[model samples]
Target: MLLSSFVRKGLLFFLLTCLSIHISKAQFLLNDSISYQPKKLTTLGISAGAVYGVSMFALNEAWYKENKREEFHFFNDAAEWKQVDKAGHFYTAFYLSALSAQSINQCGVKAKKSALLGSLAGFVLISSIEIFDGYSEAYGASVSDLIANAGGSVFYWWQQNHWQELRLQPKFSFHRTPFAPLRPAVLGENIPTEILKDYNGQTYWLSADMDKFMRFPKWLNLAVGYGAHSMLYARDATNTANGYDPYRQYYLSVDFDLTAIETDSKFVRGLIKALSVIKLPAPALEMSKKGVKFHPLYF
Candidate 1:
C-alpha cells in the first residue's frame, strides 16, 4: 500500500524534474563541453535548488495535507508486492542520478565531481520524501526503501566512474492488466493510475548493452525482466485469501539501444536519449511458478 503511494508520487516527481531538464536542455548544449565557469555552476545550483524547493512544497500541500500526521515511525514492507516496488526505487534513483549528473556535467564541472554530487543529489531528493511518510498516520517510513534508493545512486555512480557509459541500463514497460479491475482501489481504476499502481502490469528490466563487451549488434540489447501478477493485495497471504494466487514472473527479452542509432539531428538524438528509458515491445519468454509462456510482442 505504501509502496503504491510512493511509486505514484515518485513518478510525478520524476516527471516534474524531467520537464525542468527538458527546458534546460533546449537552452544549453547538453553534450558540448565548455571551459569551467563558476557563474554557470552557481546558476545551475540555484536552478536545481529552486526546483527542489517548489516541488517539495507542492507535494506537501497537494499530497500530504489530507493525510493525518503522526510521530515519526518506521515501516516494514519488505514483503509487499513481491519486492517489485523495490526494483522501482532502484530504477527511479538510477535515472534521477544519471539525469542530475548529466545536467551538472553540462555546467562545466568535471565528470567525477559532477557524478559524485549528482548521485548525492538523487539520494537526498528521494530519501527526503520518506520524511512525510514517517510523520503520516497512514504511512510510516520503510528502511528497505531507503536501502533501495541508496543502492540505485551508488550503482549509477560506480558505472559513471568506471565504465563511463551504461553497460547495463534499467528500463521499464507496462501493459493493462485484468488484475487491476479486481481491486481498483488498490491496483487502480484507470490506465494512468494503473500504470503507476498496478505491479502486475509493470516490468522492470536490466538491459545489457551486448556490444559493449563482445561482438554483438550495437543496437541490440539482451534484457532480463521481473514482474508479478494475480495480486489483488500487496501481501501474498492476503491475496491468496482473496482467491488470487500471486506469483513472481521472470522474463528474457531483446531490447533496442536507441543511443547506438547514429543521428545527425540533435533533436533526434535527444528524443532517442529520452526514449531510452522505455523498454520497447518485443518477443519475450516469461517464466513463472505456473509455467513458461511466450509473448510475440510483449510490452
Candidate 2:
C-alpha cells in the first residue's frame, strides 16, 4: 500500500514540476537567440531545489512521519509485484530524467551537459525517497528499486548521447481492472488513485521511433508493452491462495507521437511533450499465460 503511495506521489510531483517549469519559463526555453544564460540557469537551479525540498517534506509528513521510525535498513522486494513496481520505477525515472534534461536545455545549457546533469538529478530525486523508506518501520529501502532508478537515468543519458534523440521512448498506459475492486485498499478506491496503485491495470511500454530507423511515418511508432494481471497481492503465492493466479502480460501495439504534430505554439508543443508519456489507445495484441487476445482499441 505504501509502495503504491510512494509511486503515485513521486510521479505526480515530477509531472507537476515539469509542467510548471515549462510554462513559467517559456521565454527562456523558446528563445534560441540566447545560448547560455547564467540568470536562467541560476533561476532554474533554485526553483528545482525549492521544489525538491518541499516535495520531500510533504512526503515525509504524509507517508512516513505517522509511522514508527526505525534504524536505516535495506529491503529485498525484488520478488514482489512480479517486478511490475520495478518497471514503474524505471519508467518514472526515465521520464524524470528526460524532463529534467529538457528543462535544463531550455535554460541555455548545452545538450550534453544538460543530459548528464539531468540524469544525475533524476536519480537523486527518485532515490531520495528510499531514505524515507529506510527509516520507516513499515518499509525498508529497496536495493532493487535503487537499481531500477539508476537504470532509468542511465537509459535516458545513453539515448541522448548516442542518438541525440530518444529513438526508443518509455511510455505508460492504464485502465480500470476488475482486480482493483477486489483489493481496493491495496489498489485504490477511486479512478485517479487507482491508476497509480493498480499494477494489474498499468502497462509500461517501449515505443520505438520507427521513422528514425527505417522508412516509416514519423508520427507513427511501434511499441512493445509489459503488464501484469490478477495481482491482488504482491506475491504470486498469496494471490493464488486467494483464488487469483497472477501472470505477466506482454503486448505489441502502435502508438502516436504527438511531438510529430506540427504546431507553431510553444504551449502546444510543451503540452504534447508532457502528454507524450501516455500511450494512446490503438490496436494491440496481448500474449499471456492464460491465452492470446486482441484488442481493437486498448488504452
Candidate 3:
C-alpha cells in the first residue's frame, strides 16, 4: 500500500515550508557579492539531507512495514484507472520540479544551476518512492510511473530552458462525486480522504496560454483535461460484479493565470504563484464513455 494521504500531504508541506524558509533567509542575509556562499550551500545541503532522512523513516513505518517482500521487483500497473495514475505522476513531478527550480532561483542561484538541481531533486524524490514500492508485496516499482516522472521533469526543464516561462502549465481540479459513497473502503470515507484517493473526482489538465501562440488575452488559456470515473477496481470483472462501468473522461475548458494579474505585494505574488497549479472554476465540455455532458462552474 502507498503512504496514507495525510502523511503524503504532510511530507510535501514540510518540504515546501523548508524551501520557502531557506529562500526567504537567503534573500535577507545574502548580498550580491556573497550570494551562493559556501556556508549557505552547506547549511542547505544538511537541512535537505535531514528532511529526506526523516521522510524516508516515516514513510517506511507508515507504508512499507507491513507490505515489504524478500525480493525487489517490478509490477505493471499501466492499465490502472485507464492511465490516470500515470498522468498524476507526470503532473506531480512536473510541478514539483518547476516549483523547486523557481524557489532555487529566488535564493540567488543561477537559473541554469537551479533548474538542474530542481530537476534532480524532483526525480530523486519520486524515484525513491518507486524504490520503496519495489520492495512492497502489494505494489512494486512501475516502469511506466518512472517514465512519467522523467517526462514531467524533462518537460519542465526544457520549457524553462527554451522560453524562460511556462506557456503550457499542468494543473489539477477536483469536485466531490456521488460515486465515492458507493465504495468508501476502496475510494474513501470522507471528502478529504476521497479527494486524495478517488480518481473519479480528480481532473488533470494541460492549460496552454493562447497568447503564446496567437493574439489573445494574457490571463486566459485553453485547457485540455483528463479524468476517470466508476473505477472501483483495476479490472473490469470486479466492477461488473459491482454494477459499475469504468470509463475515462476528457474535457475542454478555459482557465486563468492568477499570476498574470498585477500584484505589487510579495505575499500576493507568492500566493498567485502557488495557486497557478490549480485549474480555476469555469464551464467545461466533457466527453465520457456514456456520452457528452456540460459542467457549469466546474472546479
Candidate 4:
C-alpha cells in the first residue's frame, strides 16, 4: 500500500508541478497574489489545495511512517479508485486546475468581464493539464474525469441560475462524527453565535456543487464550506506550549464518500469510513507530529 500510495502521490505531485508550468503559460507568470475572498476563484483554489492537503494528512497521518504500511488507506481516499484511478485523477486535476485558472481570472487584473471568464480560463487550463497527463506512463487519459470536470463547472454555473433552497438541500453538513453534533462548524453565518467564535457562536456552511462532487455513494464527504478559515489555533501566543505552539493548523477538508452505498456495502464501507472518521480533531494538527505541511501546486 505504501508503494502504491507513494506512486500515486508522486504522480499527483508530478502532475501538479507540470500544472504549475501550464499556469505560467496562461498568465505568462503570476501577476500578484490575492487575499482569500468568498468565491474569488483564486481563494477557492487555495481552499481546494487546503482540502487536498488536510484530507491527505487526516486520512493517513504518517504516510511514509516508521516502516512502511502494507496499505495507505483513508475513507476519503478520493473519487479516483472507485472510478478508476486514471480518469479519477484526471477529473480532480482538471477541476483543481480550472480552480486555479478561475482564481487567476478572478483576480482584479481582468476588465469588466464577468467572473465566468475566469472560470472558463480555469477550465481550459485544466483541460491542457489533462492532455499533458495523458502522455505520461504513471497516468493516462480518462473520459470519466473529463465528464466530472465538466460536471463540476456546470454544477457551479447552475448554482448561479436559481440557487433555490428548494432545488437543493438548504444547507448540508460538511463534517460530522459519531462523537458530536451533525453540522458544519459555524460561528457566524446562517446559525447565530451563542458564544463568540470561541465556544458558542454557530454558523452555517455554504453548500455548493463541490460539496457533492467530493462525496461517493457509500461514504460521507465533508467540505471546507468556508472559502477560507484559519485552522484552529490557541490564542495564547506568548507562552508557547513548551516552546512549541500547541496550536495545530487545522485546514478544513471536505469528506467524499457515499451514504447510499455505505448503507448497502455495510462491511466494506464501514471499514473505510472508520479510517476517515478520526483526523485533525480540533487539535493543533499543523503542529502535530501527524501534520502534513506542503505547498500546493501553485502556478
Candidate 4 lDDT tens digits, 1-299 = 21333334344544344334323221112222444344555554575556445544443344322333232222322332222232233333333443344345444443213224434543453444344234434344445555655654444334433341111211212232121122234221232221222111111222223433454433333333211122222223422432523222223343333322423444555453232222212211112345554323100
> What order do you get sorting by lDDT, best first?
2, 1, 3, 4
Native-to-model Cα distance after best TM-score fit, residue 22 in candidate 4, in Å? 18
Candidate 2 ranges with C-alpha deviation above 4 Å:
1-20, 23-34
State model 2's lDDT. 0.81
Candidate 1 regions off by >4 Å? 1-16, 19-33
Q: Every model's Cα RMSD, please?
A: 2.8, 2.7, 3.5, 20.4
Supply candidate 1's per-residue lDDT for 259.
78
Each prediction's TM-score versus the true structure: 0.92, 0.92, 0.89, 0.28
C-alpha lDDT values of all predictions: 0.80, 0.81, 0.75, 0.33
Number of backbone clashes in candidate 2: 0
Candidate 3's displacement at residue 269, Å, is 1.4
- By summed lDDT, the worst window of 10 consecutive residues in model 4 runs over 164-173
lDDT tens digits by residue: candidate 1, 225-288: 9999888788999988878899999999999888776667878766776678889999999999
Candidate 2 residue 29 C-alpha distance from true site, Å: 11
Best by lDDT: 2
TM-score of 3: 0.89
> How many steric overlaps does candidate 3 have?
0
